[model samples]
Each structure stands twice: as C-alpha cells, then as structure tokens.
Target: MQRYFVAPEQFRGVIITITGEDAHHAARVMRMKPDDQIIVCDGVSRSVRAVVLEASPQEIRAEAEEELLQDSEPAWSITIAQGLPKADKMELVIQKGTEIGASSFVPFESERVIVQYDGKKEAKRIERWSKIAKEAAEQAHRHRIPSIQPVQSWRQMLTLIGEFDLALFCYEREGAAAHGKGIANAVRQWKLEREKSSDEVVQNPRIVLLVGPEGGFSEREAVEAEAAGAILVGLGKRILRTETAGLVGLTCLLYESGAMEGA
Candidate 1:
C-alpha cells in the first residue's frame, strides 16, 4: 500500500486530508482513485489505514479505517552529527541515515572540513537536505521524518554534546586505542546498564554519533572532543570514509541496541 505523511490538523475526526506535494503525487503522478487503500501518518507516531474517498489536484481525502502502531522506530533516539563533506555526499548521508533509523542530523564544520556553507547557500543546502530526509523517511515507511539541523561550527557542535546520553566520536585512528573500548563494547555496556534500571526509567535514551569530514578531525579537535565527554570509538579495523562511517556505525549501534531485532 502507498503511504504519505499528513499534518495532525488534516486528520480531523475520521477524515484524512492530504494536501500539497503528497496530494499531487497521489492524484496526478500515481493516478490514485477513490477506494484506493493507503496509509497516512500524522508526522508523529500515529498512523491510520485509510481508503481514498476523493482525489483531486488540490487535495486527496481518505476515510480512516484503523489506527496502526509505528513499530519501525528504534528504542534509542539516534542522532548523527556529520561533518560537512564535499559535493553531494551529505545528501547520500541524509538519505541512507534516515533509512538506517537516524532520528536527526546535525552537519557541522570540522577542523579538516574544506567545504563552507554561508548566507543563502547555507539555507538552500539545509532545505535540500531536509527534503532528502523527508523523501527517504517516506520511502522507508517511517512514521516520523528525521530532522536536518542547520550547519554549525565545530565548537558549536561540542556544546550540544551534553544533550545526549552517549556521544560517539567517530575516529578510526587513535580513538578506540586511546579509549580502550570499541563501539560494540560501549553499546553492550550501555545495554547492560539500562537493563539494570527500572522499566519506567530511561524510556528513550538519546545518542549522538559524530563523524568527521574527508580530511577527518585533527589531533587537537580529537582532544577537545574527548574533553567534552564524547566517547571516542572506531567502527572497525579498516578505516571507513566520512560518508560511510556514520551509516555503518549507526547500523551496528541499532543492531547492538536490539533495535534491528524489532521492538
């Protein structure tokens, strides 16, 4: 069945009014007609199975049939703090990261970052990235769309480190060796500790995974990250590219956290 996200206000009572691009996609592109079964999410956790009541150029209305649970979301709210890479690599990151279950993305300027985003270009870049995230979420059948934060400086990224329960600094060279703890081990420890807590406690823990740019983080930045309480860890033996590290690490993190096994 086809799925699209709509605003909570649109889902008034038993009716779901899909407007804007989604409506256009259904009515014009897909050529959906009345009685066509589809799913609509409220951009939150709530989703309902609905049958199309009307399809037009302006809007598509559907009659709600049943409320369904959003079972695809991971237990851990994973956020990727990606270093600004060159070209269209960031788009690939946002697209695959959304599919891999990242809740949000934060693109920051790193010490080794060569690309710069400023003025109107920055705004347009973020807007494009946001759209990619939304499309990826919809294609993946995600209940909630992942957010793309505006680009920030390296120091600015540090200030947000304390917001997460765990902040993984993706350093392939010296991080794991210096910390003496691999990514898998850290995840294992987190899980074991969480299991010891009460059921109602620590319901949804937040995690931040930070990956550097093409040139990667400098030694000074690595030291600063360590001081900021960011856990330094390596993905594996072979070094992964900036674009690949976040997704690979996220996959391992989700699998280890029991998210890939399903709730």
Candidate 2:
C-alpha cells in the first residue's frame, strides 16, 4: 500500500488531511482517487490505515480505517556524528544511514574535514539532507523519519557528547584492543547492562557514533574525543572512507542490539 506522512495537526478525530506536495503526488503522481486505501503516519510514531474520502487538486482527505502498530523502529536510538566529507558523500551517508535505522545524523567539522559550511548555504544544505532522510525512511517503511541536524563546529560537537548514553569514535589508528572490547563485544556489554537494570528502564538508549573525514582525525583530536567520554574503537584492519565508516558502525550496532537480524 502507498504511504504518506501527515503532520500532527492534519489529523482531526478520524480524518487525515494530506495537503501540499503530498496531495499533489497522491492526486497526480500516484493517481489516487476516493476510496483508495493508503497508510498515513504522523512522521514520528503514530500511523493508521485510511481510505481516501475526497481527492482534489488542493488536498486529499482520508478517513482512518484502523490504527496501525508499527514496530519497524529500532530498539535503540543511534545517532551518527559524521565529520563533513567532501562534495555529495554526506548525502549518500544520510540516505543509506536512514535505511539502516539510524535515528539521526549530525555532520561536524573535524580537524581533517575539507568541506566548509558557509553561513549563507548552511540552511539549504540541511534542507537537502532532511529531504533525503525523509524519502529514504518512507521507502524503507520506517515509522519515524530520522533527523538531519545542522553542521556543528568541533567544540559544539564536544558539548553534545553528554546527551548520549554511549559515544564511540571510529578511529582507524586504534585496533579493537583499544578498549579491550571490540565493537561487537562493547554493544553486547551495553545490552547486558540494559537488561540487568530493568528497574531503571533504559528504553531506547541513545548512542552517538563518530566518523572522521577522508584524512581522518588528527592525534590531538582523537585524544580530546576520548577525554570527552567518547570511546575510541576500530572498525577493522582495513580502512574505510568517511561515508562508509558511519554506515558500518551503525550496522554493527543495530545487529548487535537485535534490531537488524542476519540470515
């Protein structure tokens, strides 16, 4: 079935009003008409099955047929704190990362980062990335759209580290032995701790995984990150590009948390 994202205000009682570009797509692109069954979500956590009651050039109104309980969201919330890569690599990262179930993305300026985010162009860049994430989420059947945060400076990035339950820096220099626990083991340990502290109920534990740009992080930056409660861990012996590293770290995290299963 086709799916559309509706704002919270658009949903009134049992009716869902889809306007703007989504309405245009439904009326023209999808060729949807009255009585067509579709799914509408609030773009956060709520979604429902609906049938179009009316379709016009200006809007499309649908009546809720039934509420849907979507369990596609991951058990843990994973945020990718990526160092700004050159050109369009950041777009590719956000697109694929959303499909892999990352909760949000934060691109930051690192010592080795080459791309510069000018004040005038920053909003447009963020808008473009947000669109990519939304489309990717819809295609992947995700209940919630992953957020695309504004680009941050090195110090700003450090300040945000305290928000997450765990912060990991994916450094190519340090091998898995840096923490005495590999990525897999570290995730398992976190999960075990979560289970033991049921009373505390760390539902949706937030994690921030940081990846550096092509040149990678400088020695000084790495030390500073480690000091700020970010664990330094290695992906593998083989080095990955800036875009590839974030996705790899997220895959390991989701798989370890039993959110993404392998055959």
Candidate 3:
C-alpha cells in the first residue's frame, strides 16, 4: 500500500487530509482515486489505514478505516553524528541510513572535514535532507521519519555529548584495550543495562554515533571526544570513507540491539 506523511493536525477524527507535494504525487503521479486504500502517518509514530474519499492535485482526503500499530522503527534511537563530507555524499548517507533504521542525523564540522555548510543556503540544504529522510522512511515502511539536525561546530557538537544515553565515536586510531570497550561489547553492555532497568524508562535510549570526515578525526579531536563521554570504537582493520563509517557504526548498533531480527 502507498504511504503518506502529514502533520498531526491534518488528521481530524476519521478524516485525513494530505496536502502539498504528497497530494500531487498521489493524485497525479500515482493516479489514485476515490475508495483506494492507503496509509497515512503523523511522522512521529501514529499511523492509520485509510480509504480515499477524494483525490486532487490541490488536496487528497481520506477516511480512516483502522489504526495501524506498526513496529517498524528500531528499538534503539540511533543518531548518526557525521562530519561534513564532500559534495552530495551527506544526502546518500541520510537516504540509505534511514532505510537501515537510523533515527536521526547530525552533521558536524571536524578538523579533517573537506566540505563546509554554506550559511546562506543552510535552510534549503536542511529541507532537502529532511525530504530525503521522509521519502526514505516511506519507502522503507518506517513508522517515523528520521530527523536532520543542522551542522554543528566542533565545540557545539562536543557540548551536546551529555544529551544522549550513550555516544559512540568511530576513530580510525581507536583500539579495544585502550579505548575501554569495542562497539559490539559496549552496545551489548548497554542493552543489558536497558533490559535490567525498570519500566520507568520513558523512551527508547538515544545513541549518537559520530564518524569523522574524509580523512577522519585528528588525534587531538579523538582525545577530546573521549573526554566528553563519547566511547571511541574501531571499525576494524580496513578504512572506510566518511560517509560509510557512520552507516557501519549504525549497522553495528542495530544488529547488536537485535533490530535486524524479525519482530
């Protein structure tokens, strides 16, 4: 079934309204018509099965038939804090990362970063990324769309380290014995802790995995990140590009959390 995302307010009781580009796609691109079945989500978990009542380029209205309880989102809230890569590589990361179950993305500036965000077009860039995430989420049958955070400076990103329950940093020079625990061990430990915790756990534990730019993080930067509560993890013997490292780290977290398993 086709899926669409709308604001929370767009849903009024049994009536659901889809506007803007989504409407255009459904009405024109897909040639959907009345009585067609589709799914609509609030982009924050809530979703419903609906039968089209009206379809047009301006707007598409549907009546909710049943509420869907989809368990498509990952158990862990994984955020990829990536260093700005060159060209459109960031877009590729966001698109594929969402399909792979990343909950969010944050672009940060690092010493080895080759590309920097332009202030003038920052809003446009963010919009593009958010759209990519939304489309990816829909295509992947995800219950919620991944969020895209604005580009953060080295200092700013470091200050936000305490925000997540855990932060994993992928360092090219990182080692298991020297850097505390390897990623697999660290994630398993964290999962065990979560399972032992009481029901008072209000939300999925948030994890921010940081990956450096093309050349990776400098020794000083890695040291400072470790000091700021970020667990440094090595991605193995071979080197990966800035765009691939975060995705690999996210995959590790997802697999460790049993997110790759069937529900």
Candidate 1, residue 217: Cα displacement in angstroms equals: 0.9
Cα lDDT for residue 135, candidate 3: 97
What TM-score number comes out for model 3?
0.93
Ranking by lDDT: 3, 1, 2
Q: Please, what is the whole-model Cα lDDT of each candidate in the order they appear?
A: 0.88, 0.88, 0.89
TM-score of 1: 0.94
Model 2, residue pairs in steric clash? none
TM-score for each candidate, following the candidate numbering: 0.94, 0.93, 0.93
On residues 136-219, what C-alpha lDDT tens digit does candidate 3 reach at each position? 999999989999999999999999888999998888775434554567887777767877888565357889999889988898
Per-residue lDDT of model 1, residues 167-202, tens digit only: 988887744465556788877887787778776557
Q: Give a tens-digit lDDT track for model 2, residues 1-263.
A: 88888789999989999998889988999999999999889986689999999997689999999999888888889999999999999999999999999999999998888876687998999999988998888888888888988889999998899889998888887654544446776677767877787478677789999999999999898889888988887888777988999999999998887886753
Worst 10 residues of 1 by lDDT: 173-182
Alpha-carbon RMSD of each model: 2.1, 2.1, 2.2
Per-prediction tally of clashes: 0, 0, 0
